[model samples]
Target: MTDTDVAPDTAAWRTPHGTSQSVSQNHLAGEVWMLLRRNIREALRSPVIAFIFPVLFPLFAETLVASSYARVSSLESFPIQPYTAYMAPGMMLLAGMMGSGYSATALVLDVQTGFLQRLRLLNVRPSAILLSRIIFDALRVLPAAVVVLLVGLALGARLESGPASVVGLLVMCSAWSVAYGGLFYIVALTTWNPQAPLAMSPLFILLMFTSTAAMPTSLQPGWLASLAHYNPFTYVTEGARALMTGPVTAHALLPAAAVLVVGIALTQGFVIPLFRRAVER
Candidate 1:
């Protein structure tokens, strides 16, 4: 056989190889599943420390505030039932935030240990890596949400909306989880200093106090009320609260969507660059 005869066979083999590589690139399904499974196993093996801060702190806050607030007739409008209901979703968000924070910390560790570099070299889709981390964080929040819901029920909380609405509420909360996780991804990428997130922890606590979680908007001081009007967290808490209580308002959905959008945009801005930097190394 001459070179011309060999050339066609070589081309044929190259074609199949290229096609296989393309297919492999597109299909990261196995990689994502494996990553998710590994995350779950690690979570299960770990101590309940993650659960303690996200789950217990919120429950403790609800218990303390509900008991104290129940006593004052002046605060009767914000009763235990509605108050606990209002606070439940905030707790859910907090759970997600904490989950994301811890996951980011882990990512930082992976970066320092050079595991992230190894991940970048793999055939796995670039998106799959970030998505897998978010999925892991979201899964961590699920049990905490369940625990909060049970506590709410025990505290006389009830959902006025039907099952569909409840599901919507869960979906919205999950979106917040992913959005917040994305923000953490940014933090992880920009700086390796653990203190960066620790410094901003107070902002989370302040968000709860500024929102409708603790009291009605009407009851808030004038300046705080104005601030709450623009706060995205208030929208989420109110959206969840409206679903939990009677008199659902369409307005709540708008801000919930807004927060989700804004959160996504802000997260992407940081995450994309961070991802590129990681891949470059």
Candidate 2:
């Protein structure tokens, strides 16, 4: 079985007590998995908060946005498919962003409660600590991933790229969630406040609306269309919608990853060092 599949505490039985430099790669990996699993468990501990809520939030968002355009045949007089189908991919990305908040909240707790200090005493690898929490946060978001896709499928969303697109979409969503989650965690670590990251909530929501999220840019006013065209989330939504309509090609997928790449590049410079300092403190 993989390290994640086993009991997390079992690592306590296997990890050799020694300096971080002396630890084998495999053992370090095991430690990372242990911490990753722990974070997942912590995040998912509340059923209402973790399970039912994530599943329902996407459905709620889709209905609300879809309802707004219900009376209109099409926004720009373009050939409009079902509103559900048009809105699904954007809703999925929004859900991923919402689900990432729990990771930041948990990190804030770690900072405030001195749990990070204990980890530093253990001599854990800084990368392992940060990456594991971020990866686990992505895992914790699986309910959103599955429930949103299922809702879309039921509402006439099709995977036009076939089986491959199914896997590709999941990978894309996971990457986006991890990158943003890591960014949120960094904000919490630096502020050392559980509520500091909440300020980001409005910014992200605005980004979603200003993009080609609910309606295509052609439907928007000239100014809004211009603004949406420049938004990174526009590319992300277009990339995802392409997977549902046509082919999962490099041309279709690269823009989706570009936002994530920029997120990682910008956040990595800050998150890793910030996390290290938090541990050192």
Candidate 3:
């Protein structure tokens, strides 16, 4: 046959058929499970390092502040259930930040190593990469949180809220973790520099200090208090705190929801275009 008369290999060149498409769809699911397992394995390999912050921070705070605050009636006015009630939210935020930051750094490494490009060329779903990273982050934080919670309970930290509140708190904390992870996605997508995560470090520190983590807003300077009042993290901490303590406040819950919504929108806005550019590059 003449060259023009010869048909192309339709089987090879054509788009994936039913089984192939099913496999492609399942690719991400399989990868997610594998990625999660890998993350757990890595974390297990470094137990002390992984557990240090989540476990110790709450204990230290409870030991130091819980008694002093308990003695002072003025400070005691704030819902002071188990010191864990206050400490848990802060730990949650810290875990979220660390997880997201580390995930972003990992993304940078993947980009540098050309893994991102290889993944892009494959039939993997784009969302799966980000989702898996987030899942890994959440799972990484869980062990630490569990350790801290157990310690807190041993230390007489009580949860005044019902089962629903406990579930809600965990769910909200997870959402916060995912939202922060998305923010990291933006950072990783926009910057190629290995040190880019450093830019976020100050912000993380600022968030911890500005919120109700270390001290009540009433104790903070007026200007600092105002900033914290407006800070979205303040809401998250407050909401989580309310969930643990008895007196749930509208002030905390409303702002937390608002912040979550705004964060999701802002992160997506930046991440989508940044991801596209990174993929194209």
Candidate 4:
């Protein structure tokens, strides 16, 4: 049996060193820590998934697109000088979104291998696995997000808001990534089909292009502008841009925060039940 499968000593449990509830909580915490470490190691082992695609690919795309569109910012209607500055925040967000597929696919592999079933047999709490996966997925984006931002800086994207805004920007990206990734998790759990999440993966590209990611809403065509106005990603991108660039105000950040809160509440509300049902089967 694996380390996770080895139960704590029964005699130790009977001792009064700790209350049963406290001991159980400690046990769950240990399990989560171990699982999280495993997940992180797995991610690091695959550099393509862990870094290249999420970091380099987005940076490349941003660089190419921003270069081609650099002159767009010279228009009187545009506010930012270099197009890369306008695109950087959205590209960083894109880096986070791109990694969601791997996270969902990893969960599918665990299901196919009966790992979750084994954990269940060991009396591991579902919450432990869920928390570990969620935390891992949230963390998986940070390195890529930071790299993309740094690349943008090299490409002449200025962070007018100063150093402290970096924290806020990363936090916004992480929150949005978690909330966005929950959809893939729900699909993976519900269908138990590894291809399901990957199949719908184009939605990430679609959402990014349909939002204010490529250009400010004012420059978009009327139909596209209207669509972007309703896209949740628009708020996220706008908020992230505000943090990185300027206009650090509630009017800029509140809508994004609200959208993230609601999205997390809705998606995670479904993910838990779906995950429980999938593992039990």
| Best candidate according to TM-score | 4
Top candidate when judged by lDDT against the true structure: 4
Predicted candidate 1 versus true structure: per-residue lDDT over 1-281, tens digit per residue? 23442233223213444642222344577666756765565456554645556677778776787667654424656543545665676666666555456667666666676555545544456676667777776667777777777787788677777666666666666777777777666777788865465455556677777877676677789998988887777887777766666457778777778888888788877887787677667
Please provide TM-scores, in order, for all candidate models, with all chains considered together: 0.82, 0.85, 0.76, 0.89
Q: Supply candidate 3's per-residue lDDT for 5.
A: 17
Judged by lDDT against the true structure, how good is candidate 2?
Answer: 0.70
Error of 4 at 142 (Å): 0.5
TM-score of 2: 0.85
What's the lDDT for all of these models? 0.66, 0.70, 0.63, 0.82
Model 4 lDDT tens row, 135-229: 88788889889999998999898889999999988888788889999999988887878888878767888889899888988899999999999
Reference-based lDDT, residue 120, model 1 = 52
> How many backbone overlaps does candidate 3 show?
0
lDDT rank order: 4, 2, 1, 3
Better of 3 and 4 by lDDT: 4
Q: How accurate is candidate 1 locally (lDDT)?
A: 0.66
Model 3, 126-156: lDDT tens digits are 6666667667766666655656555656666
Flag regions of model 3 displaced more than 4 Å.
Answer: 1-59, 64-76, 81-84, 248-251
Worst window of 10 by summed lDDT in candidate 3: 4-13
